[model samples]
Target: MFAVLELGGPNLYDYYVNQEIYSSENKYEIVANIARAAAIALNELHQRAVIHLDIKAENFVIALQENQIDLKVDPFSFKLIDFNTSVLGTDHVKANTASITKIIKAPEIRKKSKNYVNQKVDVWAFGIMIYGLLYSKLNEFNELNVNVMSDKSRYSRLDSELNYYRSNPSNTNLDIIINVFTIKKF
Candidate 1:
């Protein structure tokens, strides 16, 4: 027997960007909640020894019921999609560049490191997603330029790249920024 899955709502990219649902005041809360959900989802996958190589705003869908009013207060859930790139276990060798999105790919992927890329790649990509939700500028931050830097320069670029997010007006809530970055994967 086979089961079918249905996704009724827009992808997170459309929900956040096209819909313009986040305001300066509530943006932090909404993005944090969404990030928290994504983290939990990633943790669940990691626990099962699965690595979702494609973790991006576009790959997540927000589910809603029919005629759902007050979407802000509605109990919606995030559903991750596009598992074509997912691996059964972290022990797999050779990253599938064909399936990986350039922007959210981790540092190891960018560096093309032969070392086993563990679950931390998901965490790193999720971190980038958090930043994207905050500033609505994933394109700018996810550009491949940083991927070409030397070890020391690449790490340096990481600092400046994040600093660029800090200086944006969309991140007025410093506490939210701090909290997102402070979250440790235990």
Candidate 2:
């Protein structure tokens, strides 16, 4: 059965917050809530041998409360979504690079993805989402991403690369900054 749902506003990824706009404490809560839900959901899916290749703020929806977030679970909840890039892990197979949104892609996906990858790929995507959540504080914390979100691409470079390495570790982990451009998988 189709159950109708609604939200007060668009996702944080959909709405651009200007630097002039000051982020409130609730905003932090909202982002944290979204991240938490994603993490929990990912963990559940992994337990069932499923991996969400795509994890981003755009995938979430905020509930219409004074400070609420209601994450949507359609398209992917009832049935697995984005199977084009998803790996079944039934035969230790790797996923094809063509099956995913090249941007949010985890490096693990890129590395071992001659045919398939595993749950760790989802973790990489989660890390990227967290990066976006805390990106604004980089200036204050003197923080910098290894690859930085793509200037040419949308997803965070470091997150994508790290995700790949976690799934497919190599000596080049620290050198990903320079290797990303030269490599094909990542």
Candidate 3:
């Protein structure tokens, strides 16, 4: 069955890429709010035994206000969409790596292990999403370092960087969000 939904404003990726719209004085706060919103959404879904297999910036849209783009950063102003790949269960499921982006794929998914997917996959994607939001660019897997490396090695290095950032919080709102994302399980 299909349900009709309202067309929302530009997605996080598009909104972020537009420098003019993203040049707010409280950029960090805005990003923090967005991150929180996405986390909350994911948490709610997890609570309902749903796993959003595809979690990325493009799947989140900024809520519009009277046909205008809203940049106020209300935690509820952002909406998570694109649930075509979601599954409604709380167990390790078969890997469907084709639907997940390599940049945000969890280690288990990247390894193509059978029945290796669980809610934690969403957590991994959430952390990567926060990282992209904080850095203002969604880095490609190959772009993580100058030298070419296997996906496994690149992911290991990325995980180390995330741990480093988590340990070295700068006291910013975004840093707090990153800390939570990095340490959060399930």
How many clashes does each candidate structure show, in the order listed? Answer: 0, 9, 0
Rank all candidate structures by their TM-score, best first, as comma-separated numbers. 3, 1, 2
Candidate 1 — what's its lDDT? 0.68
Model 1 ranges off by over 4 Å: 1-4, 22-24, 65-76, 90-94, 113-115, 139-159, 163-174, 177-186
Least accurate stretch of 10 residues (summed lDDT) in model 3? 137-146
State in Å the error of residue 107, model 3: 1.9
lDDT of each: 0.68, 0.48, 0.71
CA deviation > 4 Å runs, candidate 2: 1-12, 15-22, 61-84, 111-113, 136-186
Better of 1 and 2 by TM-score: 1
Residue pairs in candidate 3 whose N, alpha carbon or C atoms collide under 3 angstroms: none
Model 3: per-residue Cα lDDT over 1-186, one tens digit each: 999979788787777777442567766766776777777777878899888888888888777777665455454466778887787787776655665666677777776634457898888888788777775546353266345667778778788877887787667744566554575558
TM-score of 2: 0.50
Q: Please, what are the lDDT tens digits per residue for candidate 1 over residues 69-182?
A: 435534447777888877777654445644476666676676553435677788888877887777666555555434674555655566578777667634455677677557
lDDT score at residue 99, model 2, on the 0-100 scale: 49
Q: TM-scores of all models?
A: 0.70, 0.50, 0.73
lDDT of 3 at 108: 70
